[model samples]
Target: MKSLFSVSVLIPVLSISMIFNSWAQNPDFPWPEGKRMALSLSFDDARASNPDPGAALLDEYGVKATFYVVPSGMESDIAAWKEVVASGHEIGNHSLYHPCSGNFVWSRNKALEDYTLERMRSELSAANEEVERLLGVRPEVFAYPCGLTYVGKGERTQSYVPLIAEMFLSGRGWKDEAPVDPYYADMAQLTGMEMDNKSFEEILPLIEAAAENRQWLVLAGHETRTEGNQTTYLSMLRKLAAYANDPANGIWIAPVGEVAKYVKEKRAEMEGNLNIPGISRPAEGETIYLTAEKGKGIGPDIKYMPEWNAFGWFTAEDRVEWDLDLPEKGKYEVWMEWSVSDEEAGKPFVLTSGEQTLEGIVKPSGSWETFQKTKIGELALEEDFNRIIVASGEDFDEGALMDLKALTLVPVGK
Candidate 1:
């Protein structure tokens, strides 16, 4: 797994400590040895469906999954839960009563809004003890119930994440939109991508997108039954298993505990010294990329913004932003690649970098896929941590002017 990223060690070997210490978005982040992405198969709530067909299917694929369990939910399946542990799947604490927000209405009796920080800690510890008793294995990983992290309501509300951090190796949250950047992620609050009610086809793109950046993707799921609330279809699971098992995909699919532990160790080693091994820097001239689709930090989220020329064309919702790690700073040549139908020609846009702003007007570019890149005005930039924004001009509505494919920044000649 260490050999997968030669770039991870590039910085220390080159004696470039400046890039190492800073939170640089080094594109060459490594996955496990020879792997392209880190993926964790996880199910929450200790459903009885997990130990049987869930664990059984995971076994068939030679993949291990993390099961975040509730004590009471496992009462009837205690024996099966033990088998799941014996079979090498991880048992993670998912709280004793599984208290959620009062907004759920049905959970008003045991709502998180009523919990105190002390009570939350006690409940979590008691849940851990219960799992250890039933499965003879104590859990090190935790997932927030209903993806909720607070303990009280309104002004009195507080995050119980600190409590979980003290008790567990890592705590995972749900319904997150992006993958984890292991270099910067806090283990105690790792985010999980929701997998409920999704088909393998629907899930493949998420893995592919995360793999594009060589990051960790934790998928949170529930139940093996299909067509029900919070259920993940077994057929879809089988397909996901097949995709992950394929050597060609280069994904390191493991239990969350294993991945978290590995990330912690590897990061610590890199921090210690580059010669400790498996450290490298990302490649130079890496294009700062962005798209219409948004997730967590990745945005210009197409949902909240306007769409023009179809789903792929990126339009402005007032502004679009990208967090870029520029290799060097200077007057860079700007290139805007856009497609326009004759009717939607001449949309105005402003590209702002720091205090410098460059205005550009789009012209017809054949068609959507047949994009044309024209040199827009140049903007000055400083190296490292530059926020570049593309925004709408004074125009009010009338839809987007063109379909944007890519934005490029090339260094200008001295």
Candidate 2:
């Protein structure tokens, strides 16, 4: 049985239009491959231990994580750090000088209390530039140094969060209580759950909580050790890796940039669906436009919907092929728009992206004159070009099942 994970039910106070059909699934919540939630392990400060045995351990588990580093920390052992980057671990800007509150005493000399927002911005920019110069990857994600976001003192204090958002795809806050809600999480200040000084036993609850609601769980850590003050236990890391790698657990483990990109694309697609006016913009990922006699590689012998523009007369052997390019790999929600006749209402059809296949039902829309939009299912799309094929099901008869219209692929977040 499918569980409809509920998030607070509200007793409607205002009058709702009866005309509006409450959609069964939430398009806004983009969980891919039926995953329960997302998990991203992010380490802060470029300690020697991080790129050393730490990267090796992660590589062994086939797990990739984000390392937010101060360029200076890795400067002495730049080659080792480069190896970490080459191992598929993401490098995030943790600012040039790791500044913190003046109250810490250690940061009193170069405290945030004396610095301005402009100085912080410049520091972050320089950090990115230096990291890119050394590692050849410009970080699109950022983590606050010392988990602090403000600069200056008292009333003069200003948050550098806005500046970070302007520069990076995402910014993480440390020791946060909740996981990020893809529908509502501010990507600039993604909540970073505490994982430092934790055992796998202590971390499992956090993961379970996030999984319950399909939220994005970001584990924030400092060192990668077992006996240190702020160490994220290596044992815990291994266990987490094993859990995420198991398909039965239903967790999508990825780097910060990869997850952020998918969430952004999915959110944009949801917003576009709600945009009634001329405000909707183009969506990301694969989009095949096949309005009857139009689009690429669609055979010339096609039939159009009577008065509806798009073509019809789909045969069991006929298939539409579209070239799909994906920079950030994930699962995409496939949507099909077409007109259906009474006889074709129950016809079986299949949509595929590589090895991922989605079986869809042909729903009736009163008559073939009306074109309706419907969700087929989700399919995994990897990096680079994907040949998305659409054809009839094995049991489908070789006849005009439905009219050919358009199909869209939007990356779903997990």
State which candidate has the highest TM-score: 1
**Top candidate (lDDT):** 2
Model 2: per-residue lDDT, tens digit, 1-414?
422111122232112232222111233366788888889999999987898678888999899999999998898899999999899999999989889998998989889999998888888889989999999999999998777889998899898889988999999999888999886678999999889888898999988988888889999998887668888889999999998999998899999899999999987765523211111122354353433322222332334332454545455544555565556567666677877878767776666655556665677867777878777666676666666655555444445667757776665653
Candidate 1 lDDT at 287 equals 42
The CA lDDT at 54 in model 2 is: 80
Clashing pairs in 1: 1-32, 1-33, 7-280, 7-281, 8-279, 8-280, 9-279, 9-280, 10-280
lDDT per model vs. reference: 0.73, 0.74
Q: Among all windows of ten consecutive residues in candidate 2, which has the lowest summed lDDT?
A: 272-281
Model 1, span 382-414: residue lDDT tens: 776666655554443555556555567666674
lDDT, residue 397, candidate 2? 44
Q: What residue runs in model 2 are displaced by over 4 Å at the alpha carbon?
A: 1-28, 272-414
